[model samples]
Target chain A: MLDISVPAKVLFHLGPVPVTNAVVAAYVSTGVLVVIALLIRRSLSSEPGRLQAFMELLFEYIDNQLLQAFGDHTRARKFFPLIMTLLLFIAIANQLSVFPLIFQVLVEDKPLLRLATSDLSQTLTLGLVVVILSHIVALSMAPLKHIGNYFRIGAILAIRSPKDIGNALIEVFLGIMDLIGELSKIISISCRLFGNLFAGDVMVAVIVSLSAFTQFIVPMPFIFLGIFSGFVQALVFSLLSIQFIAGLVNTAAANKEARLNKGKQAALEQPATA
Target chain B: MTLVIRFTHFSTHMEAEAMKFLAAGLCMGLGAIGPALGEGFVAAKAMEAMGRNPSVADKMVPNMIVAMAICESTGIYSLVISLILLFVV
Candidate 1:
């Protein structure tokens, strides 16, 4: 009885682009987020109101978690914006399905609002963005070491004899494996959220069609569960992203250590001269 | 020959559909067993963590959610497989 498919139903075309319901839902959510942000911006004051106080408390809590995860305030501050955006966007997108009247309306036969989190394209894109951002952040700070992590050509080239050749070959193999691991992270992260949310959506669709009389009251609990699952999935997406970002800190730390060693050597030489 | 196939279709279709149905049922039941145990393992460990240090409950809860989501992947995979058998065939 459930008529859902992986390809989000096309609503209309925009100059050759087929705009789907998922895109519409995403845009509407984005609009909601932008309006809320603008209102909050306008209401900014030294004296905090209830909404501002609540927002500040959330920010503080997230920042506290970041500090705990990164173990450094400055590092946490650097990543707070990315992590916070992911959490807010995902949370809103997930909860969009639970709000009534939006998902039921049809435009040319297809419903106008399909949950964005349920779409593979959306989640995969988000996962790819997180991974790419991680690499870009790492690459910006430590270009050579980040490059070496996935392609250890320099290490391989330095092999002098037959004995060292085996070690170099192993390093090359491990480097390739590491690159594959990064790709796998995108698949796993995207699919895990997609699977959970999509399964819930399908289950509800099936349940709603089971009987007309019970439909009104039967789905109430599932709707509540949907809201809870949305919150959890949103948190999971953001937390996994933060973990990926945190993974890069080690290389950055090593880069800093190298610089600090040079600085220490310079300071030692200065003391001797003095 | 065609009428024979068409008239007796339910008998043949029944076996095929039954096998498909059985595959789906088996897929779900077998697939769920591992994740159930793994999730229980996660909860048991989280309980241990809470017992050890109740103050870290907030941290443990989120971490547990993330881990549980990851662990649910196998069950999700099974669900996907079952759905394919039910719908696509």
Candidate 2:
């Protein structure tokens, strides 16, 4: 009788594209976030108001934590917006998802804004976007070296003697494993948030449906737990993204991009041209 | 005895249904053990660190929560499997 299955409910379509409740919720939430961000930016000033002061403190705390991971404030600034957006977007989305009205006001007995992140499509999009963004940044920073991270045939080719070929082959094998690791990152990242929120949703459904009288009292504890879990999941998702991006920048695996771009540009470009 | 006959009839009638519930319960129960141990370890470490230096509890708490959530994944997976067994299976 209790169904935890979140079958995608399509409300309507935009000609070719099917628009579900989850998509609509994601759009509305993103719109809400944009407006709030605009309002905050407009109000920010040299002389801070109470709201500005608190907002600034929150930003500073987040920035410092992310910067510590990156170990370079200037470079960290690039990925910081993404971290903040995801943390706040997911936090707010999680809270909105559990709100009573969203589920109560149903089109076909399905909520208009049923937990966006609980939707596989939405979670996968976020996870893939994070992974793609890290690759973009890593490549932009060090194109040749970033490419070298995967198809590390250069190491194999660099073997001077027959004796060294074994070690070079191992390095090449390791590079292939790195490529696989990048793809698995998407599945792992997406499932982590989705599973957590989906479980909470299912649990809530079960508790409420079990009995009329005990429902009100029983669900309150779970709601509190859901709130805490939402914040924790959001934090974990963003922190992981930061750690991944920082790993690329902090490692010798990626060469110094600035030096490569200017002085060693010819040598780096020669292979491509040849 | 009449009592033994009634009990035997109940089990025979509900064998399939009982097994379904049993599997779901077992799946969730056994699956939960790993995460329970993992989270316990995390909490113990967090408590030790907090006790050693009370000043950094702010930093330690969030870190502890994040790690615990990741550790909770095993339990959540068990939850998913059990839910499937309960409802979908």
Candidate 3:
């Protein structure tokens, strides 16, 4: 009697495109977020009201988290919008998904609204976006160093004696591993969110179907857990994104600093030798 | 001879089903151990820090949670694999 599957049920075709219930649910959550944002913007005041104050508090809290992680004000500010967008969207979307009542409305014999993040495609896209953006940021910050990170061309070129060949080979292998690590980063991030949400859904469903009486009150704790974990996962996702991006930025900065130090050392030594 | 053959066929089919369930169960059970220990350690350290310095307790909570979630991801990966084995495979 209980149907559990990975793929979201497609509601109908929109011209040429097939629209799944998860997409519609995602749109609803996004709409809800946009409406709240618009309302807060409209009521903007120097003297903070309840909504404005709460919004400010939320922003400042996440900003503090980012500041703590990044340890640099400019870099934190640079990435704030992306991080904030991710946090708010995911938090709201995930929180909205916990209510089982949303799934009762049947369309074409399937649930009209399903948990959006539970869908692999959506979360994978989110992970891909975060990872790709981090690379883009790193590339923009230090193009040559970022490229050299994935390709050990410099290490290979630096090799002169036979003894250096082993080290060069190791560097090349490590570079390849770094590329694989990037791919795994996307998979881990996406799968973590999807598995948590899908498991929560399954747990609640199992609890509710145990008995007629159990369905009345037994699902409360599971739902609460779902809501709590939803917010936590959202926070984790954004924080992880910040950490990944900051790491790339730090690596680039370190590379530039080392290059500058090497140049300075060369200049000082050339004058001494001359 | 025919009856013996039928029983052998049925037993093999039953054995495959039993093995599937066993694999899924083992996957989840073993996978949960590392994350449980890691999360416990993270909490223990956070508690220790909070007890030492009450002022930073609020700050430590978010970091503690982030670390715990990171620890939990491996368990979730195993859960996903098990779920796939149980349902999709």
Best by DockQ: 3
What DockQ does predicted model 3 obtain? 0.77
Worst 10 residues of 1 chain A by lDDT: A248-257
Query: Residue by residue across A80-138, what tens digits does model 2's lDDT show?
Result: 78888888899878777555667667786666667788887898899999888888877
Residue A112, model 1, lDDT: 86
Candidate 3 residue spans exceeding 4 A from truth: A98-100, A253-274, B1-15
Chain B TM-score for each model?
A: 0.82, 0.79, 0.83
lDDT of 3 by residue, A62-155 (tens): 7887898778898889889999999988898898755557888898789998889988889999999999998987787778999999898999
TM-score against truth, every candidate: 0.84, 0.82, 0.89
Give each prediction's root-mean-square deviation over alpha carbons: 5.1, 5.5, 3.9
| Fraction of true interface contacts that also occur in model 3 | 0.77
Among all candidates shown, the one with the greatest lDDT: 3
Residue A201's lDDT within candidate 2 is 84
Better of 1 and 2 by lDDT: 1
lDDT of 1 at A191: 83
Model 2 has a clash total of 0
Deviation in angstroms for A138 in model 3?
1.4
Measured with C-alpha atoms, the lDDT of residue A225 in candidate 2 is 85
| DockQ, all candidates in order | 0.42, 0.46, 0.77
Model 2 achieves a DockQ score of 0.46
